[model samples]
Target: MQVTQTANKNVLDRVFKLSEHNTNVKTEIMAGITTFMTMAYILVVNVNILADAGMDRGAVFAATAIAAFIGSTVMGLLANYPIALAPGMGLNAFFAYTVVLGMGYSWQFALCAVLIEGIIFILLTITNVREKIIDCIPSVLKHAVTAGIGLFIAFIGLSNAGIVVNGATILALGNLKDPLVLLTIVGLLLAAVLIAKNVKGAFLLAMITISAIGMVAGLVELPKGIVSAAPSLKPVFLQALSVPAEQIFSLDMVVVVFTFLFVDLFDTVGCLVGVASKGNMLDENGKLPKAKQALFADAVATTSGALLGTSTVTAYVESAAGIGDGGRTGLTAVTTGLLFLLSLFFAPVFTAIPTQATAPVLILVGVMMASSLKEIDFSDFTNAIPAFLTFAMMPLAYSIADGIIFGIISYVVLKIATKRAKEINLSLIILS
Candidate 1:
């Protein structure tokens, strides 16, 4: 037993390059725990969103944990980056609201689109298409997309918690005196205070707090068990294959595919560059080392996630929490991955989190993503108009696809009409 333990330790040390990265098994494991704590809210949040799109809550909970495991594990072993992965927030919202609910497509059909998007990303990354694509799209639009999704999902969060409702004026405030709305309000404030204080795992803590209060007040039902077998994946697994042949060629299908691809591309690039630069992992040219391997890792996880019945799995910015906690190697990520695997048994606790309990996280995540808006140059309305339309249409039109489509179209038309045709690239023109 001692010899076998030594062999396992040696393999892990070599495979994760712990010594080379100046990290140890103990530090890596602790960082991994930090990473999981920071982003653990996804187990509850993802299920709440996907369940609205007519999925099984238990199954999505299991799939979410499993996919995060695959994503972070691959990131650790393949790219050797200290970043974890999970079903992204914005893309999942788009999947549920814009594609399935608004566009009137089935959730299975949307999953098919996500699978295609992942496959395309894999091919594109292999051909070195990511950098060129990133360079082609204007930074203004990218910032706008992020901010738009923020506002859009914040709206969803508000709606879910019954803070906002359809009224005589088409939209109105819910009765603040109501129990659910009041609880959601308290959760949001508690989460805000926790975040303001820079507390670790603030979101998860807020959710648990509100949940406990709700249970005592008889607002949320008690769970049967805290730890049990993972739910069956049969409901959501392999759903992409159920997509009809005609869906592959339709105009809406193309639009859906482009939205997923563009958002995933932007998100992956932004998270990697942000975290890598923070970790001093960038090279002399301001490029991430082993960039292709990292991209391929994210792509593979995304494809596998769709097969496992979840939305686009990409690198989580929450990994930055772990990075700040002294995680400098892939072992940190591998540790995070294993924790996600362990979370499978706690699906009952996750699934029991009321919709209102997750509302604060959705709102706070929106605020974080929307910060990109400050980077946009709004001094000129030429750039400002498209940017405004981009973010505005998302919440107003109730569709992220509409937001992207309107932004690109308005951008191309505005630029050409203003004698700035040179600013519009071939890809933007094609996208328009």
Candidate 2:
């Protein structure tokens, strides 16, 4: 047993650089569980979202897990970054509601566009074009994007926990009298206290504690079973390639493809920079090392997800949860990926984890991501205006692309108006 344990330690130490990152196997494993608990809602959420496009629920559940497993594994092994990738929240919504439904395209055609977009992403990453784009983004704006996503994540958590609801005006408080909302409130306070006390795995412990309370309070249902066989993916896998040639080559299809490409590109970049900043992974130049590999993993995941039957796979902001838990090495990602794969068989147990249980983690991680806002120079009007817009528009517009677009446009306009056109680069001009 000692010999086997030593061999396992050697491999983890060598591959993940755990010691260099000031982490260990135990901490990485716990961080991985923390990250998964916070984001496991995606399994059920993805099914509901994609099923709107007429995809099979069981198939999408399998695809979501498999795609996340593939993306996180590749990211861990290749980039050695503690980031996790999954079928993204906004991208899936766009795929189903915008492209497939509003654009009158079939689900297969939408998947085709995603596949093509993934191919384009791979090309861009390999040629270093994506990295160059990251360089063009100003530091202030990067901080703003990070803070904006923080708000966006927190908004998602609030909505999930029934603390916020769509009111007749805008969003109003949900029923505080509801038992679930009360539980969420208690969970948030408990998590805050645990974190403040510097409790290790505070996030994970809070989740488990709240979940237990919820179960006892009859707010959360116990799982019907501990394990179940994973669903088949054959229903939708590679089915997009069978679309009619005419439809595939249509101008409308081209527009749809561009939309997917555009959203996935900026969203992934924004998420990586935001999450990496929280982990102190960005260099002085505000660039992530091995970013190309991360982007490539995202691209490959998107393609494989479409082939395996899901929407655009990209880096998730929820990854910041792992980083917040001291997950500084790729072992965290590999651990998260393994958990996702294990979830395929233990779906019932994971699915039983209620949203309210995870909601507090999202709220807390959002606070951590937003902490970078202190780095932004609010004294400069040109920088402040765009930064403000970027931060505000994320949760308002409910889309990362919209927030980024507003910020870039405002930045260009402010620069030109202030006779600072020299600061504007060709990349920003083109992007604008």
Candidate 3:
């Protein structure tokens, strides 16, 4: 009887401990869930693109899904941070549409770019050169980059929502006549209302709920939710890595890989810094903990993704959505990572989530990201000019790297023109 009583007490103690963890760890889990939902669109588009590229669609999806899961889980368990890693949206588009379609490069050669760039990224991380570059960036410019990402993401949300459609002659416009567009507008309004009313998970909840209604009303195309297992690694992995020596020596390849490296680095850095700030994870000196580990994790994830036959993997800015929802610690990221892994088996269900649903979430995230612009020092032209370039160019240029480049170039130009070139950091000017 005494033994039984002890066992019961032990179980109760364990339960209490778990309850405590849940209470304290609730933020991380919420953040992970929020981030996962925001990025779920990748599962659909990625598979389709791979299939069109004459690659094994199922294999690519399986690989990407698995790599993302593992990378995200490790990042959570090892780093105690809430960033996500996945095949990058922009890079993949560039690979399929630009490299394959425009440049007429073989898919195999494109894969070579992924491998080389990833290795370079890893080297950059280990050498501490990456850190120095980041440190050299003016605090104001860094903030602008972060804020610019917000604008860039917001533009993505708008484009996805059909609220803005890109065209050849005319740039873009709202689809006022489309009922689906009307529904999206309504959903956006609903999400805004809920957010203004101070509802927790308002963005996520609104996105899922409204998109479901739109699907049921036959306004949105519902994916059949069918996923076939095409998990081949050796062939595709080899194909992606086998760049000819000649190709590597070519100026064009050099340019492409350099571009890829530059974009991935700042994109990841901007995301980490932005989300960390929002989470209040910055130290007393305003430095982030385990930043190297986070950077290494991202670099490794990209390489692993390439080996597994997917596009470049990088840290996600969408993680901010979860940070805004009160996620802290790697536990939340682990939870999210687990979900992505499980998604391989349940791809159909996730694919069922309509675009209109995600639109509201993206819009909310945009609002959150863009709000940081208010924090920039508007009085100093040095700060304000770069901030403007970073903020405006993101959406306008439709590229994060372009926005960052414009900001960097403008900063250098402004400093030189104002005869305050000496005030600028030498390393930063050189890098720009």
Please tell me which predicted candidate would have the highest lDDT against the true structure: 2
Give the alpha carbon lDDT tens digit for every residue of 1-432 in model 2: 999998999899999888887889888888889988888989999999999999999989999999999999999999989899889987889889998889878899888888888888999999988888887888888999999989988988899999999999799999999999999999999999988998989999999999999988888999889989989998888987888999988998899888889988889888888888888888988888888888888999998998888999999889988888888888888888889899899999998999889998898888988887898888999999999999899989988778888999999999999999998899988888
Model 2 error, position 141 (Å): 0.8
* lDDT for 52 (candidate 3): 63
Over all chains combined, what TM-score does candidate 1 have? 0.69
Candidate 1, residue 294: how far the Cα is off, in Å? 5.2
**Each candidate's lDDT (Cα)?**
0.81, 0.89, 0.75
- Candidate 3 deviant stretches above 4 angstroms: 1-23, 167-172, 222-235, 241-252, 284-286
lDDT (tens digit, per residue) of candidate 3 on 29-147: 56677788888878778767765666777677787787788778767766677787788878888777777777877777767787788888889889877766666667677678778
Candidate 2 deviant stretches above 4 angstroms: none
Please state the error at residue 379 of candidate 1 in Å: 2.5
Give residue 151's lDDT in candidate 2 (0 to 100): 92
True-vs-predicted CA distance for residue 410, candidate 2, Å: 1.2
TM-score of each: 0.69, 0.97, 0.87
